[model samples]
Target chain A: MGSITLRAVSKTFGSTTVLRDINLVIQEGEFVVVVGPSGCGKSTLLRIVAGLERATSGHTLLDDRPIDNMPPYHRNIGMVFQNYALYPHMTVYDNLAFGMSAHKVPKKEIQTRIGQVAELLELQTLLRAKPSTLSGGQRQRVAVGRALVRQPHAFLMDEPLSNLDALLRERMRVELRRLHERLRIPTLYVTHDQTEAMTLADKLAVMRAGEVLQVGTPKTVYQQPATVFVAKFLGSPPMNLVRVESRTRGAMNPVGGAEEAVAMPAWIQEGWEDATDENGTIWCGFRPESVMKRRGPGGLEIPITVEAVETLGPRCHVHGSWGGQPITLTAEDGAMWTRGAVMRVAVPWDQVHWFHGRTERRIEPRPARLETLETGGAG
Target chain B: MSNRLSRLVPATAETPVRSAKPSHPEKHWRLPTDWREMLIGYGLILPSFWVFLVFYYGPAFFLFYIAFFHWNIFASQSQFVGLHNFAILFHQPVFWLSLFNTAYYVVLVVPVTTLLALALALLLRESAGLRGGGVTRALVFLPHVTPVVATSIIWVWIFNPNFGLANALLRVLHLPALNWLASTHWALPSVMIYTVWHSVGLYTVLFLAGLATIPRHVLEAAQMDGARGWLAFRRILWPLMGPITFFVVILVSINTMQTFSQIYTLTGGPHGGAGGPAFATTTDSLLIYQTAFLYLHFSLASAMSVVLFGLILALTLVQKLIADRFVFYR
Candidate 1:
């Protein structure tokens, strides 16, 4: 019943367009994380839904009813701000009961609801303590409790865990996920931390420069990013994108070095023969994990000069240059590689993603293969 | 290895070659050697301290001393009169009337000025985001910076019963023209109105500063909680402003009690002495000034001064206690 739909929502402050043509739907019990860099208008989009901001264009709906002109209170949406925004003057119980009293709920009902929420949030011991007396995590729990006690239609969290320390932030993320699972309310959470977005979101929307670049399940977005930005933004070490130009009909060379040119894997040539741009060039992207240590038969291989290695307990990152392009690969057995060692690294052909060099959009694998390329395979 | 270890250890077997003990390493509570530094620090403040001692504390002590003697400024010799000034003040109708007038003025001015200033501050705070807010603030604050005597004279002219702006407005409204400063019933109120006009600006600025210290997100959170307009003010803003309200009340109380310049200018000339038209505007300050300067009753004036000082101190203490009970400090 708490479904929220935003259609072509745009916001312009003076002449600068902060949010442009944002369209998203959050279903009941769905957790959508809007992940973006700072100033990406993610917060503005959330505010528009919460009615704290008015969209320059388009409509926002709550449960099939238009709420564009509705005030925040009338819309019955609970929001958790970045700083927690707890009333410093009020105790934890008062903070939790504030919203219900504002809505003129009955005294007995408010008491029962506060008791229930406090018990659920483990805030029974802190009911009489003011916000200043609570620690960061405890204050954050009280803020969430305040929103929960309201029993609003939906929740909008604006980087609710950003102020917490790293360890507490991790713990709170799990608690937030558990809370959402228990409550089953449609939630739109905004954050710049990719790990939080990937882990917490049922659906992830990657935003950049005031535009939603891609929205999909975390697995889909991680495995098949629609654009180079999404691929670069989502991963920790990020995707390694190397510019490659077709040398002949079937051979391609990583840019800046001709000695590294090799025959394009037969599967790729067969899969995207017609998908190459007019210049026969494309930007190739692959995850660090896709860079295999051992060369597989029929796979594309590149010799990498290892520069440095970072050992992270069980796994490590091998940093090096492949065909003069900087690349990092996660290696499970990184102890075998040493500085300045030249090793043959193979690229699994199926895991490689190709983008048109000019448009920067993913190129679909086509079934067609050029007959001239088969004839000119000798080159 | 045992022989080497024995050599490395300075054996206590050598009968402990003891060094001479230093003489008296500790002295009990020696004076600070940096006495020159202390002298310089005290030297820096000595001038102001001397002024305070001679002018403030000295006069306060003298006021107490001379209150017990029948003294006049022009008298060659003063007579010792124990409790005589107090006895005369107790029986003096004019002194009682002056005390009542002062209380009346304080009761009228403190609340009116504080509330007016707070209201103005709220209005100005709402417009603070607008372009003309600074100019409006400066305009309101202009009267505060103006000389009190000058503004009070202007107020006297405005309160003139004949051909005055106030009576002119009343006449335009078809109401009978009433005497303002000249009428006994209206004289104290007229002075109070002038005092509020002169002083509301400063307190408004104070309240504005207080309002600014309230975080924006807290108020926004209140609005999100469905508290708007008067509800927001009553529940959130008022409680948050408790400390500033207390401060303004104390300041206005002290300022109103010491109000002599305005009453002197408004009613001193051609009205009736300093008390004016049958002692209507005679506050403690004005009465003290009249008793000493006009009537040459120095001992009685000193007694009144001591009483006023005690009253101010007691009232201030009371206000502080009340403030401590209610004001929430973050």
Candidate 2:
């Protein structure tokens, strides 16, 4: 078990920076996943940690020992790649034994360690089978077993489940969680999948455009995203960002929303004065589930026309337009909504967020239900 | 009367005849007119087929047919000797000696060339994507695309006796460079050196292609497992290089057996040259040429051709049989 810390690490390929100022710590026995879009340098950061790619400038320390100069083997790092990368010619037994043999471990101990790992991965029955004959899932298990036999400092995984189908990916995600808990080794996993990050990571570093935008627990990052990019990136049917302009403190017109005018609540209005500019550009960001389906206290009912509806068993996505700008809200039932039907879109004042005109940082007016953010606000 | 019965009697009586008629329309049953265009397409390929029939199969069967008969350009009459030509070939000591020599050459060269090629390939593949890789590759490949005739001539000059640059360098270095081509002991080994040198480039490229297919992550994983250099090469690299080795072995064997041009150019056999004051430099092809064309012993030459063919076929089959044991497609 080890802790990995990167201090001011940055990597550049040619003129373009692949990663910038990436300072993160993976605590001992903690599983941290770095999540981002492709080209966002998530995998590059992982490679840097694995010693496969060197950082252009930075200090990376494992257990307080600088490992940036160490070769991969010398660093005692084990990496699980997206492709299993199992030696095709070797049987599962030899695949597990390869590292031990390379290190010149005794033959008897090699056999014993391989036997232990095979049993741990439940790969004993597959020990004699060649990699070519194994299914994708089994190959993945073998890859994990190969990593496990080394008992390295930490396991660095790069979207290791991306090759598996949906069902297997899910199964493997659970397997990985169980394995992490059982081993209690510090792990740094890289993935672009948000749900995987949410479920598997104790900490998430949300990266975008070569910079990490936010880093926190999954709940903290999702609930209080540091920037619009993080908020929009983390949620599916992503958070809706409606641009609004500040006019006379609280009252502002929606940017390019239909001519229908609406006023910000008195609390939202004060927050807007400090948060937004008079120039036509502040955005109100809200999640799909946060939008109210019915009129309630602290809600503003605005006119919206129903254009389309997608029924998913427990909840249906009601896709429509508000003031002629497209809006989608998750409705929790199958309601009879005719084509071109106009209805009230009640947005609870407490749930709506205000942001700066240029910078998309969330501006708070002390919403009633967010106890955590409120307490965090005190801090 | 039967036709009348077909109509007047129960219609079921003609059921078998009715079943025999075309079920679908005859126009549909015939292939489309597009077939005429297809035939025209195939007509375009006829020239290549004609070339193969004339140049490939033509010589193939003709060589065997001539092997059973004796023909001499200087003689007034060509005679059919049947198996007697073969009998005369079996009695020659040079026949067995040359066969033994050629097999020795193959044994010495093939394994060395294959191992060298694999090592060069691993080196080249590692340098892939690195700066200066293109220049490195070009340098490695220069000897291959260099005209073999020019290179062989260069080797001949380098192996020259007495006043030649080869022995002069040996004197300067205090190492004996035996007059290479002039010494019976050095000639065969010298030729193999040239052969191995030329063969390395082609096999190296083949191995490079094989190595490129090995996933980069696999190498990294091996590295993480503490496997590097020779251990990695032995465990991962060599086993996966099986297919390339198999291909190189077969190709080298075939080329070694058919190596006439270089040997002919270098030694010119005992009749044309001294053959190093012994017959050490004479290859099987050289002996056959001398017997059939030099001495008018066409029967003996014909018999030698059959033996050479047999040797080539046997080696090729043995390579295939051995290859099936180690080559892993996956």
Candidate 3:
């Protein structure tokens, strides 16, 4: 029922900066997840919001009220730590009631709230069980229930599912999504797992090297990554990035010469001259799933020399080199691919994302082209 | 062979894998190797066993044996006494005084030392990773490591009625200084103070170790839940520290009950020599020592030693019983 905003937030420990100039907002009833690899300061950003850590240079606001200097307990924020951090000596019921008791909630209300949470989390039978006796998934529910019973302004979860086994994590992920749908509490979740972020977040922020690179819907961040890092970070078998050696107006030469030069769509070519002005370095990226085995009109064809194939039940990843630059493309698992075999895959021009080499920032297709691109462009 | 195969497979398996034996080479080698391993373990323990038997159990059993006999160090033949030592001990007002004094010392030292150690531990835990923390910890523990006898002698001089640190501090605070070790009322209390100061360090460090085993996130979680300071400590920290507190209490109790050298060194000065002007500071352990070495009443001393042993064992077992109901392992 409250919004959390971080304005120009930065954190430094001695000389090394762990977070820098970060700006993010979690709207009322929205689920915002900050996702990145470990040591990227994603957790630090979440800690700043929870008031566990103070921002060095910026303010955190809960409902636009400055909360940077507020003690964590005074902030009335409920955070589920990565390890659950359940009071080992307390039973599930006591753990759920602890915060309410701390806040001096009435005894009757505490009982009612705990009963509701326990039932909601399917933890009725586990009310008397201590955390040590609970399984990982059960403990996670108790942790979530502890936060839920507080009825805080917002919720913060730090990789809460990371400790659970894969099957349990998936189940809990779905459960968490369903719970969010039902309650609509503003939540700021931080995780290193991309799949979890993509599935759970209403809005996603991708961070790298102490800075947020992109903040948008998961689909938009995946489709229109702001930087080369984002393009490479968000997907499984990530986007294949090939360096552009040179380009002349409408035609661009990719570094690998095994294939002929690819024809640049007019929209892409419009920004090439202005975007690649620095050191004239450019990167051509296309998602692995974007590569079709059959050619489409205006699609660039590249022959991939297959070196290894990984069969993943329904689909397979074909890892290979194109002109000495490594590329991975997915194919139906039934397809046979031997080592050193050459296969041709076509990537439609619209699927190609261009990036400037020096800045590594994505070169957006012009506004005029964006509409046509969204509607499935004609060659 | 079937039993072995069944042990390897699930109980409800439709078909047991008959190929289990060849897959596990350890099954064939386990018996002889286990024998050899046990032999190595016993070999490693043999030297300590020899020392304990010669220096500990042998004397203990000899003490029990001679408790029934009035043995003299100078005489070859000694008279047998059946329950005579116990009869005399129960009637002796000095023996009752020593027991009462020992009880008083344990009561004073155990709880006070525990609370002080816990407070110091909490302070140290807060200051951990701060500058001078290591130096503070080492300074606190320094007294425990110093020879008890040496420190006790220094303490004797410090308790001097006219010109000592104890009286000097009293005077600085504008309070009158009284006879410390020399006074019957003040003698035991002074020794208790010294005992706590000397031993609180070790218990504090024990507490620090217990606190270290707790996860940092648990406390942070408590903070987020609006539990801070005293509430967090009472609900989270104290509950978690149950086992160690139990251990420290038992250790301090046993140690306080058996206290000897400090009393011998501190109180053994001009006025009455050792057990005070009128046996004011005489504890059970000191009484046993005096009876055996000073008065040469070995049988009577052995009887007292048995009582002390019985007291310590009974106290430890009672503590264990109480702790089992309260302590949480995780």
Candidate 4:
């Protein structure tokens, strides 16, 4: 019954617009993660949905009822803040019981609910301790317990796990996922960490500069990013994007001084053939993992001089220059290469992403050519 | 063969032996390590420490010693009269009356001033950066910095029964004019009003500082938890401000107890005999001054001083004990 729909939501602070035309929907039991760089308005979006902030335009509906005009408390949404925000003066038991007491739940029912939540969150033994006495992870569990005890229609979390150490963050991530599955409340979690977005989200919304660049399943966004921004933002060391000028119809020359020409894959050329620009320029993007050492190449081969190598146990990132543009390629540890060594790297034609130079919008490859490219390449 | 013979000799026997008596090296007299630095540190604070000891503690100890004796400024010698001054003070109705008046003044001033300051702080905190905020704060704080004697003189004029601003305003509202500082019934109240106006601004600034320390996210979280406005203040803001409230209570209590300048300026000087109109406004401090300087009962005044000091100390300790039960340090 907890479904949230946002329509044409925008927020402006004075003259500066913090969010624009934000349209999204979360089905019952869905977990949506909104992610962006710092100051991309992800936190503001959560606040607006929580009714802590007012949107300049548009409506937010929870369970098919308009809640934009409602106060934060009346909106029936629970929020876990980035800092936990537990009342320092109150014991953990009281912290969890505060909202229930304020809403005038029966005293007997409050006790029962608190007992159940404490058992569920494994916080029974620490119920009398103040928040100052609890460990960071323990405090986090208490914060989640506080939110869960209310049994709100939905939950809004603003970087709840960002305060933990890396190992604890990973463990909490799994626990949160399990908690979501068990409770099935529609939750909107916001974080700057892409790993959290990818792992915890049933649907991921990537935002940049006050607008959602793309929203899709993590797998879809990862494999087929809709924009150069999304492609560059979602991956570690990021995807390698090269600027090129389209020469004639099927070939492209690097925009810089390098004299190398790369033949556009038949599928990419076919996708853009009908909508060819007069200047014939485009931006090409591919993930670091997609580029491999040339192995009896039929795919496009680009020669690169290695500038640096970062060995990360099982895999190493090879930082080098390709056609005067800096590119990073992730290779297995067995692909050992030293600095200043020239190596030929092959990009699977099907894996290459094409975007218009000016607008940076994805151009869908022709279906038949894409199928051939996928089958012809080794998986 | 020679090398083998040399190796066969015992090592200890070949070594040189010292005399049975051990020699003691000359002990040089030197300061301990870091002594110079400690000296320098003490040297830096010695002036202020000396002033406090000489001016404050010196008089306090003298007063305590003289309270047990019949001491007079004109007499050549003081006679030791153990507990005689205290015994006389206990039997006097004027002493009890002054003590009660002082307690009344404290009761009126502390809570009213603290609450008013907290309310003003809450209202002004949100508008701190707006157009009129700085000007308003400065105006409110002006009386605190102004000379008490000067402001009390202005208040005397304002409290004038005939043409003063207070009476004029009352007349505009169609109320009868009444005596302020001149009447026995209104004297203490008039002094309390002036003291509150002069002291509230300082507490207001203190409360504002305390309010700023409360993290914004905590309040937002409270609002999200279905606690708004008064509920949020009661549950979150008030509890979080416990330490500051305790501090403000102690400070205002002490300040009100020791108030002298306003009383002196408002009720006329010692020639007019401090607590005028049948001692209606006589607080402990004013009574102590009038008894010793005006009536030449120095020993009795010293005894009253000791009692007043004890009362202030007991009150502060009791407040601290109570605060420990409720105020959250963190």
Winner by lDDT: 3
lDDT of 3: 0.88
Report the C-alpha lDDT of model 2 over B222-273, residue by residue, as the tens digit.
Answer: 8888788888888987788788788888887788776765676666533476
Candidate 3 docking class: medium
lDDT of 3 at B17: 43
When 1 and 3 are scored with TM-score, the better candidate is: 3
lDDT of 1 by residue, B1-330 (tens): 242234336773222321343346475344453664466568869999999999999988989989999886777888899998989998999888888999999998999999999999999998987999999999999899999888888887899998789899999999998899889999999999899999999999999999999877677666667667786787678888998999999999999999999889898753546567888898999989888877788899999998899999999999999989888777
Number of clashing residue pairs, candidate 1: 0
Q: A1-379 in candidate 1: lDDT tens per residue? A: 3999999999999899998998899999999999999999999999898888899999999998999999876887888888888877788888888878888999999999999999888999999998999999999999888878889899889999999999999999999999998999999999999999999999999998888888889998998787878889989799999888876667787786656577676655664544556676678888898988888875668788899999999999999987788889999987899999999888877788877677676654544224424564210
**Model 2 Cα lDDT, one tens digit per residue, A170-251:** 9999999999989988999999999899999999889988888888999888887777788888987888777776545556
Q: Write the per-residue lDDT of candidate 4 for residues B1-330, one digit (tens) a residue.
A: 332233345553222322442354245344553675467567868999999999999999999999999898888999999999999999999999999999999998999999999999988987887899999998878889999989999998999998889889889999988798889999899999999999999999999999999988888888888998788889999999998988999999999998888898899864575687678888999989888877889899999999999999999999999999989988
Return whichever of 3 and 4 wins on TM-score: 3
In angstroms, how far off is A351's CA in candidate 2? Answer: 2.8
- DockQ winner among the candidates? 3
TM-score of 3: 0.91
Every model's DockQ: 0.37, 0.56, 0.69, 0.57
Question: Which of candidates 2 and 3 is the stronger one according to lDDT?
Answer: 3
Model 3, residue B73: C-alpha shift (Å): 1.9
TM-score of 1: 0.87
Candidate lDDT (C-alpha), each: 0.86, 0.80, 0.88, 0.87
Question: iRMS of each prediction in angstroms?
Answer: 1.5, 1.1, 0.7, 0.8
Q: In model 4, which residue pairs have backbone atoms overlapping below 3 Å?
A: none
Q: What TM-score does the predicted chain A of each candidate obtain versus native chain A?
A: 0.93, 0.92, 0.92, 0.92
RMSD to native, candidate 3:
6.3
Per-residue lDDT value at B117 in model 4: 92
